[model samples]
Structure formats: structure tokens, C-alpha cells
Target: MKEIRALAFDVFGTVVDWRASIIREGESLGRRKGLSVNWAAFADAWRAGYQPSMERVRRGEIPWTNLDGLHRALLEELLEKFGIEGLDEAEKDHLNKVWHRLAPWPDVPEGLARLRERYVLATLSNGNVSLLVEMAKRASLPWDLILSAELVRRYKPDPEVYLMAPRLLDLEPQEVMMVAAHPDDLRAAAEVGLATALVRRPLEFGPGRSFRIPESGFDLVAGDFVELAQRLLGREATAGPRRRGAPRPPSPG
Candidate 1:
């Protein structure tokens, strides 16, 4: 992995806690509107719209629609489905921008800072450029650059999205490591010849959500960003699953 010089991160659940953040925003809105909806379920349904919406664009059924627009579209449908009413256009717009203000996971900022000390760190998320920029500021995420699907007009698991990062960075695919909590994203990146790192986020969809690492083929599997940084920096080589009982890296203070 000596060739790896930069890290491209999947930002949604990987760097930020999307589910919790969305639930917080939804519940706040519910309280203000005197509605008592299942906020968590609402969050899931809204997120469920995410992939199929992106799929439409990826399949060329729609033009290059940014995430903000797609999110708003889903939000409109969800509002009707959940019997939520009385939200004006402006209020709805504000709610839809919740994705732009997600909170970072506990280990993100510090881990990214440490990793940035040795490698170029950027977001290779499907979020639009504006959404990512606002999220970085809101979450205090330290990103060197924000590369989005808006640039390539494609989403993750698509070769175009994975290849776009290296193309924009002027680096070879092998020189960039794709760090994500999702196996599918990493698998897609690996298929495109980029190095892959799996950062486990067991509660990404909330504590009850079941998650399993589908494979152990990633260059590294870490419980958190701090652990990932340690392994990447120490040049720890891995040819199989991470051994049990390795000392856990402390989260940066």
C-alpha cells in the first residue's frame, strides 16, 4: 500500500452520523408542529429514498440532479405519506437541508487531522458540492477538498464516481485509498483499482440496525477512524482479517 498517498472518504454514515442527525431534526420539527410522528421511521424512509433517487440519475433516467434536490423530492413524498401537514415551502426547504448539517461521528475530526498529517484527505461522497461544503463547516470536519458525484453525475458503486476522484486529484487509482463504513462502496472502489479501508460504524443506522462486514478483502478493517489512522500510518500490512486483541487506538482529544 506504499502507493496510497491520499484518502477519499464516504461521508454520509462513514464520517457523519446521518441517522441520528436526521432523527434529531425531524423530531424537532415534529415538536414545533405539534405532531407526534415516528421520527426514526421517518428518517429511515427519507434515507430509503436516497439510493433509488440516485439510481435514477445513475441510470440516465434523469439528468444530473444534485443530492439537495433529490432529498427535497423525497421529503415532499414522505411528508404526504406520513400525514405531516402545515409545513410551508420555506420550512420544508429548511428541513431538507438537514443533510448539510449532520454531526460528525465521535472519531472523525481528530482521526482525519491525524491522517491528514501524512496523507491527502478529501471527501468522495455522493453529496453535492454545496451540501458537502456546508456539512464540513457545520460538523467542523477537516477536509482538504470535497469531491462529489455532482462532478461526475454518478453515484457510488458506479465506476464513474470512483474514477472521478483520482482523475481530479491527478493520481492513479492505486494511489488513493477509499475509506468507507459500507462494504459495497469499498468493493466498488476496489474493483476500480483503488485501495480500500473499512471503518466499522456498527450503529450507523441506529443501535438496532444489523450490520455485517460482508468480506475481509479490504486492505484494512478498523473499528474506528483512530484505529484506521494508526494502521495506515504505521504501514501495517494486512493479508487477512484483523487479528483480535490489537490495542485500540485512543480517540484524539
Candidate 2:
């Protein structure tokens, strides 16, 4: 096996707790507007539309649209379906931008900091660049780069999207590991020659969801980012300060 030179991650469920963050933000929005809604279901519905919306683009039913645009379209439908009303355009825009404010899992910041010591970390997500940038800034996610489907204008599970990371980094496919929580994403990356790691996110859909780990075919599987670092670095990973004079990774363009 080749030594992994960089790690490309799936952002939504894997790096950030999008479901919980959306629910929390939705609840707050509900309170401010005094709207009676089941935010949990709302969050789920919004996310459920994600793949189908992207498929519309992939199938040429619609022209290429970024994730934010797709999300906004879905939000409009959801608002009407859930009987949510009276929100102006500005308020609707802010609510749609909730994806930009998602908080990372508790283990992420520390684990990513530890991993940054030895590897280039980048996001391999369907999210548009601006959304990824704002999310990173808000969460303090230490990504060396933000490579997204928006860059290639194709969503994940597409070979082009998986291949973009290695091409951008000037590395062979084997040298860039794809870390994600979804087996389908990993499988797609593996088919395209990248190394794969499964990071289990059991609560990604909320509580009482059944999650079964894949028994084989991955280079690594860890419970979270911290464990991922420990497995890769072969030591206990901590959220400690970097070594003196260690240069910070370059900011994503």
C-alpha cells in the first residue's frame, strides 16, 4: 500500500453534525417566528431532498446549480408543505444559510488539529465553495483546502468529484485517502482508485438509528476524527499546541 499523502473528507454528516445543528437552528428560528413546527422532521425533510435535487442536475433535467441553490429551492417547497409562512426573502435567505453555520462534532476540532500536524486535510464535499468556506470559518475547521463538487460542477459518487482531490494535490489516487461516514461514498472513491476510510457517524440521522460497520475493504475505520488520527499517527492524538516553529497549513483558496 502507498503512504497516504493527504486526506479528503465528506463534510456534511462526516465532519459536521449537520442534522443536529440544523434542528437546533430550526428550533431557534421557530421560536423567533412563533411558528409551530416539528423541526426534527423539517430538518430531515430538507436533507432528504438533497440527493434527489442533485440527481435532477446530474440527469440534465436542470442546468448546473450549486448546493446552496438546490437547498433554497427545496426550502421553498418545505416551507409551503409545512405550513410555514410570513418569512420575507431576507429571513428565508438567512434560514437557508443555516448550512453555513453547522457546528462540528465534539471530536472534530481537536482531532483535525492533531491530524494537521502530519497531513494535508481537505473537504471533498458536494457543498459549494462559499458555503464550505463560511462553515469552516464559523466552526474553526482546519482544512488545508476546500475541494468541492462546485469546483468540478459535479456531485459526489461521481468519478470526477472523487478524482478532483488527487488532481488538485498533484498526487496519485492511492496517495489521497477519502474519509467519509457513508459506505456508498467510500465505495465510489475506492472504485476510482483512492484509499478509503469509514468514520462511523451513528447519530447522523438522529437517535435510534441502526448503523452497521462494513466488515472489510476499507484502509481504516474509526469512531471519530480523534480515533482516526490515533490510528493513522500510531499514537494518542490530543488537542495540544503545535510544535515550535511548525508552519501552519496554507489557507484554502
Candidate 3:
């Protein structure tokens, strides 16, 4: 591979453990709501609404909408399914925004801090700009830029969002890389000539999160963000045989 430069990341599961965080927080919400529902199962059902809701937009059945709106639609449905009641408009509004306050995995902040030193790190997610900005402030993520499908008015698995990065950065597609915890997302990036790295997030779905990691379309697979950054720095430092005192190449594309 030509030396890696900028790294774009998928924010939801890759950077933050959306499932576990939501389940944990939602469990607390459920208790406060006096709804003794299965929070984990509710999380799964809520997630189940995601693709279908996106499909509605993708298929033109509905206008383009961000994940926040999609999550709200499902949250209201889930509240009824769990028999949660007595929530006023303000309560419901606060509850619908629960997704915005997801906590990162323990490794996230430290790892991202390390990586930010060696790369032009930014989000390339389906999340809205405000949502990501708020989440970064809340979670202390050191993102250089917060990019979203809201900018492109589309989501991941769509070429527009993937391709928008190069245009904004004024770089060719091959010069930028995508770092994610998903093979499918990597495949999509790689298909468009962008470099790819897989940052494994095994705790993303709790203990049952799959340990069997896939190996494909990934220029490198890292255990977390820190490891990925170190590897990138080392790779750039040694991309070519050079004189002992020669300066290392720059990291950003």
C-alpha cells in the first residue's frame, strides 16, 4: 500500500459502543419509567428499526432523514411496546434524545487521543453534525472534523457519503483511508478505492459481542485506536529504505 494518511471513521459502533451504552442507559430509563421491560431486547428491537427506516429513504418511500429521526420513530414505538406511560411531551423529547448521550467504550478516548496525534482524524458517519459535535463534547473525542451523512443527505453504504470526504479534503479517493469496526463498511470504502483499516471493538455488544473477527479489505487490523495510530506512525516512518537521519514522511494526505 502507498503510505496511509488521513483516516475517516464510522462513529456509531466503531467509535462508540452504541448497543451496550444504549442498553445500559435505557435500563436506567426503564426503571425510572417504572417499565420493567427487557432493555437488551428492547435495544435489539430498536436497532431492528434502523435498516428498514433507512430503506424507506433509500427506496424513496420516505424523504431523506438522519438516524436521530429514525431512532425517534422507533423509540416511540418501543415505549408503547414496553408499556411505558405518563411521559409528557418534555419527558418524551428528553427520552428520544437518549441516543445522543451514548458513552464511548473505555478504550475510545485514550485511543482516539493517541491516533489524533498522527493523523487527520475525522468522522465519516451517518450521524448528524450536531449529534456528533455534542457526543464528542460529552465523550471527549478529539476529532479534527465532524463529518456526517447530514452533509451529503445520505447514509453509509451509500457512495455519496464515502466519496464526499475526498472532495472536502481536496484529495483523491486513494489518499484517504476509512477506519471502522465493520468489514462491510470497509468493503464499501475499499470498493471506491479508499484504503481501509479495521479497528476491532469486541465489547461493542457486551459479552456476546462476536470474537470471530473478519479479515478482509483491511490494510491493517488494530485492537483499538492507539494501536492503529502507533502502527500508522511506524509504517510511515519506515515506508521506504532511507538514510538514518532522513526525516519521516508526513502523515496526512
| Highest TM-score against the true fold, candidate | 2
lDDT by residue (tens digit), candidate 3, 1-253? 7545578999888888778877777778778877687888887788778778888988899898888888888888988997877889898777677677878877778777877776788899988888899888988888888889899888779998898887787667777899999898999998888999999887766676577878864899998877887788788777754457755555344
**CA-RMSD of model 2:** 5.5
**Model with the higher lDDT, candidate 2 or 3:** 2
lDDT of 1 by residue, 26-73 (tens): 888888999879999998898889999998987899988999999999
CA lDDT, every prediction? 0.88, 0.91, 0.81
Tally clashing residue pairs in candidate 2: 0
Candidate 1, residue 64: how far the Cα is off, in Å = 2.0
Each prediction's Cα RMSD?
A: 7.7, 5.5, 3.7
**Clashing residue pairs in candidate 2, if any?**
none
Highest-scoring model, lDDT = 2
- Give me the runs in candidate 1 sitting further than 4 Å from their true place: 236-253
Task: Output the TM-score of candidate 1.
Answer: 0.91
Scored by lDDT, model 2 comes in at: 0.91
lDDT per residue for candidate 2 within 108-225, as digits (tens), equals: 9999999999899999999999999999999999999999999889888899999999888888888899999999999999998999989989999999974776848898889999
